[model samples]
Target: MKQSLILTILVTLTSFQRASAIPFQVRADLDSCLNSAGLTSIYPSSSGYASAAQAYNLRFQYSPAALVYPTSENAVAAAVKCAGSLNVPVSARSGGHSYAAYGLGGQDGALVVDLSKLKAITINSDQTATIQTGNRLGDVALTLYNNGGRAMPHGTSPEVGVGGHLGCGGFGLDSRMWGLFLDQALSARVVLSNGTIVAASPSENSDLFWAIRGAAPSFGIVTEYKFKTYPAPSSNIIFSYSYWSTPQATASSIFSAFQTFAQTSAPPTLGIQAILASAGAPGQLYVSLTGVFYGTKSDFNNAINPLLTKIPKPQGTSVVTYGWLDSLVQLGGQSLNTSTTPDGTDTFFAKSLMVPQEAPMTSAAIQSFFNYLGNQGTSSDTVSLTTLYSMHCEP
Candidate 1:
């Protein structure tokens, strides 16, 4: 089960928000409504509004009409009912880390429903876990591991909210074996535009069940999710390889070699991605291949050694084993605890896509792409890491 977007009937209102600023009176009216409903809220005039309205990416910042914290499902319904009546747009804020900032309504003056207080993880008698949308990936990881040695497939970012990550396509290093994080969902509780509480699953509201999993932003607000959990693997292999100060030709060959190996021989337990980054100066290419292999150290070596023979020796490389949770902490470069959520922000542009395996790029095409990448003079400020989803063969 997954609770997702609070985007619903008022979605149309978000488009008009940009045409002009919301009336000051409307803000006051919303402030009054929240007060009357007894919901914990912050208004623009409130000192906490600035922090409450903060989005994860510094590239985008939207002024929400009002930020409300609903502690229970009934309270979530009341908040929606209030917004639907006042014609105010609504956006649910879980981790507040949408790449496009859609979590800020993709516009201005929408009512931001902050779900931070709803972080709860319940291990059920069945082989499943019920998680509130407010819990971040790190929170979810630590809670499940500490309680029941349970695990689920999810992205590497710890601050990303479960609502947004799983609502979208939740992919992780282990996705090749377990599929997406969303695939673990059995059902979810949602608050509809009518302010009605409903359960969406395969057998109930089947249409909505499908819609929310892939595109929950336009559907309704999900409060909690019940997911099938897997026993945490005992052994995990985390690996990294970096090529620095490399020429375009070498970078292209490195990426090409990785693609060939990924498509032909990578195991499902092996999840890897190649990163192409712009170094300090123009014509400088920095490439890295990093991911996790969920198996014994000997087995990982047997699988990765063959791929190593195909490419030039990397300037830096690492192949170490760690416990399941430790592997996540190392790969994420942060603590996986909910005690204190991170508040880091960056301004950059990044996009992701998958290249078809049937029509792999010719060596000429690969060279051409790298040629342009090496010539780009953009600095770290404007351009950040660009990752290629090269693990397509790990079906």
Candidate 2:
């Protein structure tokens, strides 16, 4: 009797598995998705899917089971619910500016929810900017700049998405004077994991609001962000200083000096970085300190000359002050392209670290890292380096 009962239970489980293995359920849901008039504005067919699959970081491509555009938070919620009901994975894409694999890295047979249609900026009378998740930094900056020269301290690249940057603690030229991008954040509208839309602000949903300010991406997909804005200066100056190192020892000294200058004497108006390389024909053991200053030439020179004196006499120095937009373009190393997000390309691998001081081990680690680059057969010209310097504001 025990053996017979066990056999019946096994048969029942096997029958259930076979019944659920078919795609009929998925197909029915997909048919409904196709007929989703509510999603007609956002859902793209296979032909449309090809273009949407392109990502800013050109490292890879994503092909989703379906592509839907969410015009509003409600639309976004609807799409999320649909995906959940169908038991499909959902990947949210705002400006498609993810540097790593997170943006379009959808699992197999997942729904790629694209939020490009939600690009809108509403500026209230009180100097607050409410931007949709899909808005790019360039557009927002230009708009604010035109509206009485207002600006926010943000990344040097204009094509970056406000959503991605704010989500990850954004920083750029004005970071030292101001702070990380998250510092200016006022609030956000986010969709929870369970398909509910909620407003997160300091006064309402305060815990979620705090989480939204720094780590919204990890917790939920934010649809809109509100930021505090300020009046921007008319023009700015960018000074680039470069030096050649005949030996690795000189390179190490230059790095150490820059570290001391950054920690002890650096000014908030100045943005600085130290670049190192080989000497000779191909050029190795070279170091450079680059800067972007927000003040006048005289004021900037006063702050920079002492710093310059610490390193070897520069082989080349260039100073150009222009309209803020022109200055931003030069900083990004790219001409302005309106159709696509700025600095959105899948061409390189980038990693950043925050170090308080430079030590022998720091130099050794960098040398080792560059050595590994050689092993990977990477040329020096193709590699780019960025070093950040931070200083505390006066009490």
Candidate 3:
């Protein structure tokens, strides 16, 4: 009786799998539909398909039934309509930086709407700019800077796409002062799931505007974003301090002091990050604090001196002043004149948690973290725990 029951279960599972699979004929039908919609950049599971599915994270590798590159909003609408008509799942790919590689659909046999071809940036007369969703942060920064010394707060990674980044509430060096990337956004143009194009703002499609601000991927395909830009600061003061320590208590002490400083003393124009890593001698650890201040050197020194006194002694320290664009290069770990493509891709898994502002970092918690790191076999693979000072800013 047991053997018969197991056989029945296996047969049922196999049947369900087969039912869900996308057959060759179905894929061909979808491809034909996409091609018929006037999309010339369509790629099926042959010739250029592999490169079309590449993502910033190597771990997310999925081959969609069809990948369509739509150059204009009309083209995007056509692709969406055709995908819906054919009953094929669809995903939008901008900078292809989805952590789980969701830009290509977490599973197989979906249609990917590749938006990399739409790269237009128009600066309005009123200090506002209309940016296409396909523009990467690096390209956006350089373009804005070169055009009029304008800037916007965004993620540190230069390769992050404006669509998914702003859609998910982007934060970066200037975030503490200017707020998130979404906060600067005045409006957006989105293609809804029903294949209709709509403008969303505070006064138009207000509900959709609100929903798309933070929950964008679920709502629609963002075609473009209009943002209010600010005059770029003339220069930035970058500083770094590092300490070597094997004891968990030392790490805890440094973290506790840094947290207190970040909460109480740090100004909005100052951005600081703390990194604890097992990159020292075998079985040892180190702590590093790095930051950038978007103000005069004198003002930066005055504001950071008190915090420096509270932290433990650093084994080394460095400080430098740089122009606005150059400072971004330093922060992004890219050469001054390098292209905007992402530096590299890697295979990794990540987990995250949000700690409340009022909560304290106790020594016990720090020791537990250290213990966990110590047990993760020594294969020269590095592990890092990073903390950034983030506070709510008025929009």
Ten-residue segment with the worst summed lDDT in candidate 1?
4-13
C-alpha TM-scores of all predictions:
0.90, 0.82, 0.89
Ranked candidates, highest TM-score first: 1, 3, 2
Q: What is the C-alpha lDDT of each candidate?
A: 0.77, 0.64, 0.74
What's the CA error at residue 41 for candidate 3, in Å? 3.6
Off by over 4 Å in 3: 1-21, 280-283, 335-343, 374-382, 389-395
How many collisions between residues are there in candidate 2? 13
Clashing pairs in 3: none
Candidate 1 runs further than 4 Å off: 1-20, 377-395
What does candidate 3's lDDT look like per residue over 1-395, in tens digits?
00000000000011111112467777777778777787865455367776776755665567677788899998998888887887888888887777667788667777888888899999998989999998888889998999999999887778778887888778686877788898888999999888999999999999999988887888889999999999999978889988766455566677777767766777888877776666444446677888789999899999888778987778889999999899999998875332534346655555444455566555577567665554441334544544453421111
Q: After superposition on all CA atoms, what RMSD does each candidate show versus the true structure?
A: 6.2, 12.7, 9.3
Q: Alpha-carbon error at 189 in model 1, in Å?
A: 0.6
How far in Å is the alpha carbon of 153 misplaced in model 3? Answer: 0.3
